[model samples]
Target: MARPTKFQPSYCDQVIEHMTEGASLTSFAAEIGVARSTINEWMEAHPDFAHSVRIAKAKCAAWWEKRGRELAVAGGGNPALVMFGLKNMGADDWHETQRVEQKTTLEAVDPLSALLTQIAEGGRRITDRA
Candidate 1:
């Protein structure tokens, strides 16, 4: 039989709070005197805890983005770092990517054949005018 888990229900709230506050799992585990691998195991075993962690991660991303904006407004932050952080952390919502799709119909006729046809047509017109 497998040994029982060391997870405590009491730590749920704190874990969620810390995650939303931008505390990584490793740091949070260290702060709570738990192993990082143990936390990951708890998340896998507890569906509710996993859901809470997901929500907290979104909140953490929002917090980071807000901080980036505030720093940019204050003009005291490194522009490159701020942009890189925001672009990576808020990629789905903040990153900009352009997609252009051009569609064309292609025929099996060769380009030289088409050009020669045009020239032949022009020659016929010229001869008629002569």
Candidate 2:
């Protein structure tokens, strides 16, 4: 016989509530006496639960961003943590970095050597500039 599932329908509501309150999946799982993988599997098996979790996580992100902004404005928060939260919450508007790649080639690097050679050969004189 197959084993019974540990998930209960009511857990969907509880998970969403906890998630919106800033609980991460791992922490939430621990709080509810389940493994993180179990929660993940439950989400995969229950589409409605997955959707609810997604919404809750989005709200949680917004909540964290708001908290970060509040701390930044209050003048006593960790600047690094605030920036990290803001950057993650609003990546499109608050990207912390940009990457660029450039390539180039120099073709006439021997000009100075050639000039010295000419001077040595008496083809040009040091006083030519004067």
Candidate 3:
């Protein structure tokens, strides 16, 4: 007679994900209705599994920082936007850059008006006099 093998599931990725979210292996096991032993096995099999989940959860962070810099540069802040938002506003981090940028943009520009301006006129860029 052949012996039965342990069950391994594709959701191992998700199971490891939950565990990385500080979901204790036991709780993660229960959440996915699997055994804690199974989650442990998955983590053991793939070391990058945990790192992947953490990165996935915080995926928006790096992206927003990059775009924040983009918008600041486009809005004429250049490198100074980072400094002004960080040092002057006590931002201390990219997360704060988003909040400050959002607040300023909202207070300063009406979306509909900005849209109309863009639609009414081509992107009229000014040539540098220098």
**Global CA lDDT computed for model 2:** 0.76
TM-score pick, better of 1 and 3: 1
How far in Å is the alpha carbon of 36 misplaced in model 3? 0.8
Candidate with maximal lDDT: 2
TM-score of each: 0.58, 0.65, 0.26
**Which pairs clash in model 3?**
none
Stretch of 10 with least lDDT, candidate 1: 121-130
Question: Candidate 1, residues 28-126: lDDT per residue as tens digits?
Answer: 789888888887888988877777767766776686787787886887867776667557655677787899999999768898887678778886543
Give lDDT tens digits, candidate 2, residues 86-121.
566545556757689999986876988987987888
Which one is best on TM-score? 2
- Weakest ten-residue segment in model 3 by summed lDDT: 88-97
Off by over 4 Å in 2: 84-95, 104-130
After superposing all C-alphas onto the true structure, candidate 2 shows an RMSD in angstroms of 9.4
